[model samples]
Target: MQDIAVGGSTVSRTDILGQVEAVGVGSFWATDEEGRLVYLSAKALDALGGGGESLIGRPLVEIFSEVQQANGEEAQRTLGFQLRSHSRFDNMIVRVDVAGDDETGQRQTRWWRVSGKPYKDGNDRFCGYRGSSIDITAEYGRQLEAAQHSQFDPLTGLANRRRMGSRLSAMLTACKGAGRSCALVMLDLDRFKQVNDTLGHPAGDELLKQVADRLKTVIKDRGEIGRLGGDEFQIILPDIDDRGDLTGLAGRIIQMISQPYSINGKRAIVGTSVGVAIAPYDGVESDELNAAADLALYAAKGSGRGLCRFYTADLRESAELDSRIEENLRDALVKGEMRMNYQPLVSPHDHTVHAFEALMRWEPEDGRPVSPAKFIPIAEQTDLIVQLGGWALRQACEDAVQWPTQLRVAVNVSAKQFMNADFPKVVAAALAGSGLEPNRLDLEITESVFVGDVEAVDKTFAALKRLGVRLVMDDFGTGYSSLGYLNRAPFDKIKIDQSFVHGCTEGGTTNPAIISAIVALAKALGMETVAEGVEAMDELALVTERGADLIQGYIYSRPLTHDAIMERSGTENFVFPPSGPPRYRAGRMNFFRKIGVIHEDHYYKAMLRNLSRTGAWIEGLAGVPEGTDLILDLGGGQLAVSKVVRAAEAAQGLKFETALIGDGNDGLMTRHRVSPYALATAGMPLAALPAGSYPLAEQMSASRSPRKFFEVEV
Candidate 1:
């Protein structure tokens, strides 16, 4: 052995190597041409709990595995691949498994940074590998922890936005190549700001943690969840394209997140709106998909929070429309374009108009009338609602004072408006300025007002009551219809939501039971009940039999303009006799519009006289016998299959094969229409349905034949 000078004494190379190994600074290892371990240093064997002899003939890859990163994710490079490639490796980190369990009953693990060089024989044949390793367990752990800190949220312990972006990009790329699909669901917590404002940031952080926990429980291993900053989260679901399943998952997530959370011994309630976009269908790229989902989220929030919306081309248009509305609404009040229409609430017992609910109507300077349902929510989201509410209240008060009769004017108060500190002042000012008796003004509030700060809500109620205005709980059963709200709030009346009344009179429906229960509950609480949206005689009779104290709907009269109200308010007791369909008929509309009827390879133009959920009456088509099957093209891709129930010269009453569903605006619509997909199949481009006839004449070859029924000029 060669000797070297050390500390003024000659030391051999072997002695130096021995000293290095004994001090645990490094260890030597060698593998045969087969990559099987031929030699392992005693020190390394000691670190691995004395398995050197047993591991001598084992493959080097079997003794050491790739190190796992601190995030509990496996490192990409593999020891086996490097060994098999017979390539030189420098400072490759790996994990070694020890022989026995540690005190905690977990298998002992050790990490090492290994460097190896492939060796060759004189004949240039592959021989083996000579390597050295150093214990790097502690250093590796630190690096891994640092990496985890960068990848995960410290507060929620969920993957942070950075990790999520990287994962999403990678997943989208892989799925694209494999012809698979992925879904990205974006969620925004509703009313989360209120929680932070009320309970402090610490509580908010705790709530986020609980939210993360709930997400994990709900998502399980089906998807990966990441916190995309405050109150926003993203989920990556692999291999999921079914909209039905995605919708179910989104709903579950919303419900789970909406459940009340207990933070710091106080209860906090919040809701989540979700937007979902499936890969390739919504977009092929990650960023594109994210943008689609964001648009969907915007639509979900716009339509009303606590709902989920899937990405569609129409959502962009709807979003644009909402933006236009938001911009135009700011100038509406100043421009005097806003108005109120009064809908009479009649006494069922005597058929007299007891009160009129003030409904806001907005007609822009250059546009047609906009529904209150569309713009009121936008106003509520901003400070515009305070101005709007004040205006409505004052106008209603002034109008009511001018009436000859003591008719109460009920004005709807939104949750945001009600929560305002100066709301009571606004009401008092309206009442004092108009000189209207407080008892003649009824404030209609929904259950949403009871969402936050219960004590403040109670104080508002007390203040309003002190002013002598009657309070009515509106849309009682549509929301969180807790008896708790009725118990806490001193409501003089409860308005059963129209949803429960829509099909109450239909046979085999459960709505009647629910309505009866609500009536009983209201009676027991000494609060009168009003059934809303009653549009037929049977509906009226059912509500009357259920002991509803009042009724308000088209069955009596539609909302009237201020001029109409004045004309009808000729006497102090204006009583309008009930004049609707004899029995409950699926709500009908006097459409009187031109439509096309397809019969036996011929299309005849006809006039739609009236429309109902279950049927329609058309004129201008003569010689169409009863029980004749026909397709009515209602335009814009809506086609209904009907059988003529009654036929007369130039007139036919047809019954639809399928009943229409509500159109979300209290109008009837077909459950399924001519889809853009079908249009595409018929050689049309895949795009939103354009305004015109669907199943175009050329596409429907069956309609090419000559007319069978004589067409009458409309």
Candidate 2:
């Protein structure tokens, strides 16, 4: 009953038309002038998935809708617009209303490619629209899969570097316009290379996947996390510029990633270092922000692994300085610029010197002193650490040989140096060349030595044990705390890290409990435990009570030069009295920094002489009476509310209303900085804060309060 045209031939074939409808590839659909479906073939009804009877008079637009492009760009025209214009539309992709599911119980989207044209009656009057929609589910799914592959890492299911860069760019653009802030976090795994080199590549892949999953649990919906290849990762946090919050998040991330992972029935532990940068504060652009974060990460890892550092302005200078030092480090030993400073470790039971830890000191020919923290990592990166490590071992043996025969010398070993195949030969050469007793030579090793093949690491330990030098574990409980390390490797002593000793006497800290647990574990293992970094009497008393076998830190002495050590080598001089502060006080940094002080409406310049978490000593303003309230501007839009607690002729000690936060570069800062939004409201252009202070607008008002204090012209 219908005329069909095919292959330049026309014939009346009702069976051929029925076969077309039965094939289910697609079917005819027709709607009234008002756009309600009036006619639908069997296949068209099946495509809607159900309720064929109810769909007879429903609007076709209700069944399918337009979607944004996969890359999140807006479409040029919507399906509704095409329908309303009564224009011809062909091969337009649309989403179906029915919720379909994939095999993994995840919801899968359904798509269709539709073609339509407006039809007219015999009188050439507009009647309705006739459309055909083919099943494009499989083809559209492949397109979506390709997009996902481009944006996500195949190994970890996290966003790739390209995707993260795009995301950061888009977020910065949006936040810059809205006067909001975003923070970027850069982190990478420590000791991850060992996992890869020890285990197979497949195990490394599994570990990375596990790390990504843990990051997701911590991040939740707070931000986007991406893998920047290898063991490196990045996260984007929105609407936050508070340093205090960033510190907490960074700490959480480090702690989370430092936990142990199980890969192929083998227990692996790794540490993480985090660097944080805030947009419109650290930088307003993505590349600038990334550079800032990278510098912070460098500082974090260099200081110690498993730490978090916030990007500060001074890190760039420090990085440049490190670069120069790295270049000079190649010849520092040959130039006689490096030496060992000894700090004694005394036995608590006898109160006598038992051993001395050799600390490396670097002084360049130009009289510039380089901190070990800054140069050590650089040496490691340039493979100069191997040479330095060998030199230090030999120098310690030579230095200790000149002291009492019974005294022991401890030399710190880098993971790289300890893992070298000829490490035992180096130890033997140092001992044989210096004529020092093997038992008197202690080799201090960190937990990070468990990086490569377990069997190979065991062989190295065995080889070192055969050298007759005692093995002492350094910085215990700081990172990689698997009991398997202690169980397998024979350790003679354990050195408790200084971090636990810092605030062990403080009421709220859990450091005392951790120290006690460490001592107990060591005691049970028949290992001698030395509490490190005891700088005050209270800390010494606490560690003494915890049953530590030995104590080493400033309570006895700072690092002594080789001549100083020899000056006290006699038996009578072995006893060192505990001399330090009577009680523990939180560390305070003393420096001269010009800052702005505002009392009432008057702004005066002051010098911050010393800073701590709880208070600061300021000089410049006279007659600042005790109990007087004021605002201290520490530059870069930072304001601290304080009260004058003690007053002198031209100096005052101020107690902060809120405790200050660490700038992550061993400096103090306000918890929150003044925002760009506030600056824009005060008539400045909307942008990141520039250097120096931003005075309060209310204090800059026309009606100023009378000045009650004198500004000392120091």
Candidate 3:
């Protein structure tokens, strides 16, 4: 009921074939009630290919040649039956031959589905037929595939168990009715597990497939064959008519399975046992026949594994021990007895301890300690690793925050733990609850974590970054992580796996080359590199000489307690040494009660106008670079100092290194940035002023570019 404008006027029809053609559906007309072609949609013309428009007014029979006309009449009669019965065939199969080219220069027949229904005119009079003919060649291909698989096996493409069963059932039924004979043979390969164990499962599978092919050649049109399962096969011989036929088929199968197979350059001479059961003689039922065949199989196995035997009643004792070990592992995780240990990572220089890496350890009271290589894989398969990883993170962070400021702790993360949806939030909450600084925490993840759901990894990393925790790519150069991911990932450091480190100390020069390459790559990417498993001084020296930033192994003390960390950091003098700086001592004589230092005749108030170690800025005359090294010469004496550290928008003052004791009762302090003085010049509150107004032009320019970009009115 939609309106459309024509060239001059609008026309309406109860059934608009022309409108349907305009919308690209194939539409056509037929003359009178005889179904003669009149007009057609462009889609119909295109679908018919070249010169199809020439037969617009031709009779429907003219569209087909002589042979097709006969087929067309039969199709019409079938369609008439369906219509009269009011039965709809949703996807009834039909085929048509269209002209096509093959490899050679000749035409070939192509198939498509043809549909038709009676077309009616305005007065409710039947005019002709109209329906869409769709291409269903792909459907026909799938149908063929279904039929093929229904009969043939997926692995060897020989007859499968279902097909073989059907064939055997039919043959047995026929033989029982006709007073003939038939036999069923079963096969089981011997030492097949040994082949799989020694040569790999793929080779064993190839052997089984070859066995099927060989059996087919030997039996040749005399029986049906199938693969029942791994190393198990079945054969059905029908129209046998005697016991000799059953014996012959069994011998042929035994001979086929006894042959040698060459797989992956390895020669394997494997053997199989065959069992036979005759229908109408052994048992009448299919299950009984199969039972007898199984008994025969067991007898064949008992007779030395590579020969055939007839079924007997006493061979039902050995049915396999249900060796599924997966159930015992399921309940092992819930009892809560997993444990972990920490390994100390020592600084190669001065043996100052840096961090402790948390390593998982598990030992069940009833059983021996489970190897990390064993239980870790199982834990990862379940959710045990996720819970274990969270426990590890929390414990590490708690212990880390209690350690001296110089040492930062690291925890290894498994691939499963890294992919956990709550990993980032868990890490953040752990850090916050532990009262630990984010920079003191490091998460070490293996390269395998990057292989899965990269988008999820990316989001996880983004969440971790919000917590300010450092990420280390654990065991670099051992996994499939491309150099590209290393470049893009938010990794703070890369730890060379212990295996590679172990090789680096070996006298051979190859390890050095590989380690050097890794170091160079890390350097190029602005990442710190650490070498693990440096157990000797020579190894330490080699790694340190090659510019390895960190070394962790047994060369130093193992993971220590908080008291041990304090002891390692040295005595109270080393932990809390005194700091010296300019002291403004009046002695009832010094003016203005503030110390001053002169830099290029601009006197900087040493105490009030100086930088605080707590990162506050005060007004001072001298302006220095963000990281400039300078000496402050107070009226008392000179003290070595560095300039303020630069920050985003706001600049921070330097960390004091050497504030020396000057003349009598006076201490020399460092100079400060002139930013506060610039702030006083503007009416704006001192803290509110932009950093750019300072005489420290470089710091001002870089730190406050956004503030300088636009004009501001006084």
- Model 3: per-residue lDDT, tens digit, 1-714? 465568987766524755766664444434445556665556556655545566577665445321222111123335435444433333334443334333453433323444555656688777765555444456566766776767767889887777777767767788767656667888877657657765778887888888888988988898778887788888887755243345555666665665556777765655667787766556656788888888777656544344566543334543221112123344544665555566666556655556678777666657776656545544554566687788878877876776678668899897668877788888989988999999999899876565323455788999899889999998777544337568669898988876566646555447677778888889988899888876656666777888788777766544444455556456522221112222211112222233333232233343333433222232333334466432333321123344556522222244446432211112222222222333344232322333334443333322221221111111
**Strongest candidate by lDDT:** 2
Which run of 10 residues does model 3 get worst, by summed lDDT? 705-714
lDDT of 3 at 357: 81
Better of 1 and 2 by lDDT: 2
Off by over 4 Å in 3: 1-336, 363-368, 505-509, 536-538, 557-714
How many steric clashes between backbone atoms does each model show?
Answer: 0, 0, 2
**Whole-structure CA lDDT of model 1:** 0.81
Q: List, residue by residue over 1-714, the lDDT tens digit for candidate 1.
A: 589887889988867777899987899899899888898877888777744466788888888787766665557876678778888888887888755635655567788899999999899888999999999889888887898888998889899988998888989899768767888999988777777876788888898899999999999999899998998999999988655567677778877876667787776677778888777667878789999999878767766666677777667787788888989999998999999899999999899888999999998889899987789767877788888998999999988898865688999997778988999999999999999999999999987676544567788999999999999999887654357678878899999999788878789989999999999999999998999999888889999998998999988888988888887667454786777776765567898678878775556778998988889999998888998999887764567899999999999999999876543233565644454335535553322234445445345444334656898876
Best by TM-score: 2
Q: Write the per-residue lDDT of candidate 2 for residues 407-517, one digit (tens) a residue.
A: 899999998898788999999999999999899999999877775456677888899889898999999987666466889888999999998998799999999899999
For model 1, state the Cα shift of residue 386 in Å.
1.5
RMSD for all candidates, in order, please. Answer: 7.2, 5.0, 34.6
The parts of candidate 1 lying over 4 Å away from their true place are: 1-18, 23-109, 113-133, 404-406, 504-510, 541-547, 576-714
The 0-to-1 C-alpha lDDT of every candidate, in the order given, reads 0.81, 0.83, 0.59
RMSD (CA, angstroms), candidate 1: 7.2
